[model samples]
Target: MEQLTFSSAQEILGFLDSALGRDLLLVPVWMRNLAYRLACLQEPDNTALLRRAASDLQFVGPDWNDTAHQLLRSAEALEAARRDGGLGH
Candidate 1:
């Protein structure tokens, strides 16, 4: 199956929110990272950081037929997030 591209965190959030709103048990990567970071500060364990990194490190951008296009979109998000200081580990 082909993957889809998302432009912004807002786009990702919107897609996931819509896709998962019908399912209450769904946990988005962003929310999970927020929780993981909070947990790490309280507990400060290796496991917490590992969990957070594993969840937050991956990119979920659009999936174009051209892998380069897909990767570029993902890179754009990462770069934007990095510049805006939106990316947190």
Candidate 2:
């Protein structure tokens, strides 16, 4: 399968919204992760986006266990940092 690439968050969001609208549960896990990764690249310090991406991956089930775990860890670390005042508000 050809990999899907996104130049911006709007493109990813549009794809995801369309998928959700069509009830397309068959959207590949890698594609979902790619969207999340691209969004992260655009806004690396957005903890809320990280958490939402992790939750979104979890919602897709366990096909990509390592990627899901990594996202969860990243979100947790960012949340912890924010709580500890490691990240400036």
Best by lDDT: 2
Model 1: what TM-score?
0.28
Residue pairs with colliding backbones in model 1 are 4-62, 4-63, 5-62, 5-63
Tell me model 1's lDDT, rounded to 2 decimals.
0.44
lDDT by residue (1-89, candidate 1, tens digit) is 01223133344345445765786346664554454334344433333243333434343233312433433455556667767987662
lDDT of 2 by residue, 1-89 (tens): 23346357666667777886787575776677778788788877776777778778778778656666786787788778989999885
Candidate 1 Cα misplacement greater than 4 A, ranges: 1-25, 48-52, 59-89
Q: What clash pairs does model 2 have?
A: none
The Cα local distance difference test for each model comes to 0.44, 0.73
Give candidate 1's error at residue 74 in angstroms: 25
True-vs-predicted CA distance for residue 83, candidate 2, Å? 2.1
Candidate 2 segments whose C-alpha is farther than 4 A from its true place:
1-6
Best by TM-score: 2
